[model samples]
Target: MNERATLITNEIVEAIRGVLRKNNVTFGEYRAGFMHLVKTQQAGEIPLLTDVFFNSTIVDIENESRKGTRADLQGPYFVPDAPVITDGQIAVEDEHKDKPVMVLRGKVTDLEGNPVAGAEIDIWHSTPDGRYSGIEKHGNMDKKFYRGRVMTSEDGSYEARSITPVPYQIPNKGPTGHLLENIMGGHSWRPAHVHYWVKAPGLRDVINQAYFEGDEWIGNDSCNGGLDEMVIPEVIENGERIMEVDFKLEPAVAKSLQAAE
Candidate 1:
């Protein structure tokens, strides 16, 4: 080994020797390699560590087209139990904005493209003013008016009424955004996206954000790798903007019944 490698190896050996000298327990010489493996595994990359320990590919994140998943960390702007309306209906707060209201509707299907009935859909986003609640204080903005959830029917269809999401800057106060803003030099802004957490009995929990097309910042989204399929084009009908996007999930081979058991 080179001088540096030899020094590192000696240091590792000395550390292991120190541990052996201090411990009450006895370890066989054959187990020394196992200790090295454990140390190396712990110091390995994040994906390898997660896969080795969790047995789930939690880090094998991929987008709709099997590309790397981008990190889009939206803060606490979500509300629970909003109303469930029908297709083609406007889904937004009573108060209006210069940007038009958009109707988002779609069916939740499994790998085979069959509708996955009873899938839970939760959607939330920041207001047009680019500030999310729980962060804004002493404001008259409608509370919980733009966020909600619904379950897919037998046909796996769900809909939510939300205003057209506006591209917003990441809060520089948060650790993640702060680090990005300081290091990346002015490209920490996320594209316009409505965040959704979709869950079904036989499928994995899907936490995704659907972005809007033609957004100036879509190319620079700090998350989701700026996938094109996740970007829905603004559809206009009779002078109003609309957005429709569908989600396809992989079916779970053995649906977890841990709750019942």
Candidate 2:
């Protein structure tokens, strides 16, 4: 193996050994656990270990705040070019309006507090039932529901109407569920949140999620994507849930082109 691979393998082996020692696991116990994992895989009831490990790594990187809005994982459900929306448009369909209605409004600004007018903010989120739009589970193939793109106006402000997202468990029938629930002894739920992909000229493109405050999973996100800085408090305005959040973008670093001699 190459140097990096060898180092990583050794590190993982050491970590496993440490856990085994700490847990007082004997050879027989270790063998039994290993066999159980193998059997689970053979039965096709679990996801690949690589995917679980990758997701765990993502969880380990949460709450890293540098400047501006701290970034979070994009999860795995972003679709590009959702129908463009004007200010104050509703993104959710009437059929899915069982949950409390919410209005999300925000301003896109630069680090220096200057408005980034005309910035594109692509937003999407899970249904109140925790299923995403345009996915097979939702039976939405052609039309995009609960997802759209809106541009900031001249003052860098935008708004949209939708249902408030709620916490829901991740897919629990697979190996990832097994790892989180059985082995890790942790809940497999993600906190209520909305995803945003913001882009503007001369600014760094940001793909992040805004979480809801007071969510049960906010302190225990399955994917480790929750951070206090990303949390938005909810208010009741005219019988609708209202969340106002502002985004600050950092100027994009210019890349130099190769000069022709």
Candidate 3:
């Protein structure tokens, strides 16, 4: 390249880093990309997308309050067809046999306050004894245990039969656990929560965990940063437990290939 062109390129690269430093956009890979774009002043060529693009997109609206201040992701431990149940019913065999039998019901809606009819809600959780079924400590029990799925109706509503979840220690044998213990000095316990992965046509998929209200670990949800807005309350009705929570998903992006598919 010519000397002048090389000089211009260097100047542009420095300019990008300067802008990124000024904005304090610190997060390693993202910081580097943003700096490069800013330096070239042709950021459009780099394809800019927000975090919301990759994760679940949430909406703010009436009755759209976040549940569980201690919300965290449900993790990767659930199986399918866990048995669809009705109100005031228990599906999993709780070893405690004394834990509360909870009835959970709620609706899945979009950002515009419209019901996302026919959405699929996959729900799962640890057993009443605070152990997930099928683990080494727990035998493979075909008791229709603490996992299940339900579909939202025309009104975007769903109901499931389960028990109140209890806080348990996160798996400390995995990479995430190693990072917590070695690098972050963090423990491996998460507040009790129910996993919900909601999906429907034209709606962004939401894989989130709704936490119990007033739990001691609410402030320490592993996801971090977004609390005070994800916890939901449990209501006891005539000897049955009921927890209601709703999910607001973002609309399908207009140009998204998934939308076309």
Q: Which structure among the candidates has the greatest lDDT?
A: 2
Clashes of each: 3, 2, 11
Provide the overall lDDT of each model, using Cα atoms, as 2-decimal numbers.
0.60, 0.76, 0.64
- Candidate 2, 199-261: lDDT as tens digits: 899886777888777888887777666667778876789998877878998876455521210
Q: Top model by TM-score, which number?
A: 2
RMSD of 3: 10.5
Report the C-alpha lDDT of model 1 over 153-180, residue by residue, as the tens digit.
Answer: 8998876555676887654444344335
Model 2 TM-score on a 0 to 1 scale: 0.80
Error of 3 at 64 (Å): 17
Ranking of candidates on TM-score, top first? 2, 3, 1
> For model 3, how does the per-residue alpha-carbon lDDT over 1-261 read when each residue is reduced to its tens digit?
578789979997999789878888769957665565464343332121222121222222211433311223435466665666544254656455677777678888887778888888877778766777645545776636677668888998888777778887655554445445655797666688878778789766766677777787787744342345557775678897667878787764456654443
TM agreement with the true structure for every prediction: 0.60, 0.80, 0.61
Better model by TM-score: candidate 2 vs candidate 3: 2
